[model samples]
Target chain A: MTSTLKTFMEEQLPIIESHMYEFVEDLTAPTSLKEAMLYSLKAGGKRVRPLFVIAVMEYLNNPTKAGYTVGAAVEMIHTYSLIHDDLPSMDNDDFRRGKPTNHKVFGEAAAILAGDALNTLPFGILARLEDVSAEQKVELIRLLSETAGAEGMVGGQVLDIEGEKRQLTLDELVRVHENKTGAILRFSIEAGAILAGATQEQRNLFVEYAYHIGLAFQIKDDILDIEGTTEELGKTAGKDVASEKSTYPALLTLDGAKEKLAEHATKAHACLEKIPSNSKYLADLTDYIINRNK
Target chain B: MTSTLKTFMEEQLPIIESHMYEFVEDLTAPTSLKEAMLYSLKAGGKRVRPLFVIAVMEYLNNPTKAGYTVGAAVEMIHTYSLIHDDLPSMDNDDFRRGKPTNHKVFGEAAAILAGDALNTLPFGILARLEDVSAEQKVELIRLLSETAGAEGMVGGQVLDIEGEKRQLTLDELVRVHENKTGAILRFSIEAGAILAGATQEQRNLFVEYAYHIGLAFQIKDDILDIEGTTEELGKTAGKDVASEKSTYPALLTLDGAKEKLAEHATKAHACLEKIPSNSKYLADLTDYIINRNK
Candidate 1:
């Protein structure tokens, strides 16, 4: 059953990748500087962020055309964040997604410039959406900007970085993860609904579903870092332990972490129940998140 | 006569700053994060980018409220670039506008995150435009995004960093400046016209005007770096020369540089003639770019 899900995800990956690449290609600046931006973009991630976007959009039965622009926009923002995160002055990582990071290939200055370009390009993509209603598109851009911007992910990142040298309470840890990782994830689900012209109530429910799922998603990764094999989890396992940064397992006992995951997954499922019964795709997504091993 | 123009520009600066601050404040998030975003935004710069946006919008005299939203959006992008530019990994600067840079107050990670936050906030602001047709707002966001994104300014910055390490031919250099510094300057002006609903012909004229003025603005900066005082410039004097970065002075004799400035200024002035005589702002802006001192 898990293999079936992975195969399905694998199929969707190329579709998202193709659309994302098209968007990037269309928007590449007519200059050599674009080399870095393109390098980081094509440098390859799991396309997980974009897959989340496309999955949710499909779950809601929104036409791909309506959500595709903002979907690509979200991926651009995510990719840019990774590029900057791996810079020497930041995480100082040499590799990302099993490959040389953006800064490594492009040089630090060009990498910085490339990330900056990706950051700004999403808005450009959002701005160009024509299939959706103008009002819907505007709202979509607003949601994405907030999700990706300081008040959301960046602020979360700041808090996370600051928390590195200090011990954070459980609430504090949740706050950091919510902003750093959760905001965009929440946006990923809700944006699809917004573009699909989902009702306000429906959008709110989608947000609720995304919230718990986002939190669980982080906790599960913590579990995976401890238990999963190196091959299963690409880069490295137990690296978080080496970093001494807070994690779900660090704060909670193994059983406690498992309980929290169960509770959150249940809540996520409850949110899904509020959706129309026809949302088979979202149902699959909820299961995929809870059951994903790597 | 120049003082009158300077005074008007000065008066416009505060209005621009207040609008920018207020718009940033409107973004909902944790208070601390909001403060982080506002820290650099409120820190003073020339406000040239936002002013370009407003001046162009003022030219069209459009009553649309989206103009103000777009005005704030560009300022955020400009501020973000400055914040990133001041980072240690980039220019390694400590002071901007005679005060500590964003990274000095916030740690590098926080500073990087703050810059990222500011960069994405523009799209959110654009999405929240209260008074424009949704279609108009979408168009505005699209136009601004392209000019600011990798293909435009980011691409240019890449070229700039690379050019620093190697000799660039005059055409290569010009293409770079056009993308890096010139694209946003052009966007600032072009965006104003865009929000004001300038026809294609009007937009074309402004494009011509922006091109010459943008280059003239850079040329003037190169001259000022050599001739201007640190106190007046609000940045380290001769830093450009110290860094051995390419500049107009590096490529041309002082006399040659001056002649080029005069030629660009002349073209900028000629472009202004295409606008109606009643448009005093357009005429004054061309004059302002060429004649102003720090």
Candidate 2:
């Protein structure tokens, strides 16, 4: 089953990767910066966010091209965030995805520039996607800006930074995790629905599914921090505990955290039930999020 | 004569400032990031880029609202660039517009994030503009991205940064300045025309006008580095000379630089001649660029 999941994931992964390469290539400028950006971009991640974007788009039966613009865009934003997040001022992690983080290779200033270059590359890619109605394009840009900006990912980062060495309520913890991890997840699903011309009702249900899965995803991450080895997770484990940062397992017992994960998984699958039975991608993604070990 | 120019500049500056503030409040995330963003935003600069955007819009008789979104957006992108440029690794300047640079106040990391926040916020604002057709909006986003990204401003920056402490030919110098300073200027004028619904012919002329003035603007800047005092220029004078970076004046004799400025100014005026004779603001802007002391 593990092998099968990896195989299935491997097949879908390159489609997003190819689109990301094309979009980044199209978006970056000045040969040196483009070369630098392309180097780190192709270095590798699970392509989780872009895959989420395309998978959601596929689930909605939208033509895949629309997702390319947003797919690459979200990846760039995520990559840029990672590049910046791992800088010396923040997490200061040296390795990401089994390679040196951007700052590690590029130095802080160039890494910052590379990240800045990557961040703006998305809007450039979004601008290039053709044949979508103007309304949909505008909607896509709006969704992206909101998710990537302060109210979403960056806001979560601030809280994450600020919340260090202090206790956080479950509600506050949820807010941070949701914005940090969930906003992009929600954006991925919603963009799929919007492009597929899914009814608002359908999109709302997808949002519901994303919300639950988003929470589950983070809880699993917290669980992995305690249970998984560094080699397996490809990042240092137990750092949250070491740093006294809040996590599901920090705020609750391991059993309680495990129970929360189960509850969110159940809610995610429940939200999936409200959608058409034909959305195998949605169903599989929900299961995949709860079941995946890495 | 100086008072006339000052009066004209002063009167229009506040209109742009108030419009920018109101739009940020409506669109930006309610977080400290936004507050930091507004601090640099309202802290003050010439607002020249947005003024160019709006002047073209007004010349075309477009609604002021249309200009607000792109106007604010161009400013955000411009400001973000300045914030990053002022970092310790880059220009390392402490003062801008006679106040501490964003990095100085916020520290490098937060300053970087603050810039990232502001950079993305422009699109958020642009996406919210009402009454624009979807097509126009997409085009506007694309244009702004093209101007701001590596192929344009960022690319120019790379050249400028790398070219320092080395000799560059006149062609290389022009190429750098065009990308660094010219593209955004072109974007400003063309953005206004695009928003205001100028015909291709009218836009073509404005494009020509912007191209000329953009070059003239840089030449004037180069001249100012030599001719103006630090107090009058409001920043350190001769930093370029000190840095060994090539400028128009660096490559050309002072007389040659002045002569080139006049030649570019004449070309800028000829581009304006294609518009109706009554377009005083457009004409006045060209004159302002050529004659300004600081």
Best by DockQ: 1
Per-residue lDDT of candidate 1, residues A118-233 (tens digit): 88888777777776677777887888888888778887877777788788899999998899889989888888777666788988998998899989988888888888876777
Docking class of 2: medium
True contacts kept of each: 0.85, 0.60
Q: What is the interface RMSD of each candidate, in Å?
A: 1.8, 2.0
Worst 10 residues of 2 chain A by lDDT: A1-10
Q: Which stretches of candidate 2 lie over 4 Å from their true place?
A: A1-8, A26-28, B1-8, B27-30
Q: Taking the tens digit of each residue's C-alpha lDDT, what string does model 1 give over B134-180?
A: 88778777877887777777777666776888767778878888887
Provide the fnat value for model 1, as a fraction from 0 to 1. Answer: 0.85
Candidate 2 clashing pairs?
none
Distance from true position, residue A143, model 2, in Å? 0.8
Candidate 1, after superposition: displacement of residue A135 in Å?
1.6
Residue lDDT tens for model 2, A152-172: 887677767767748999998
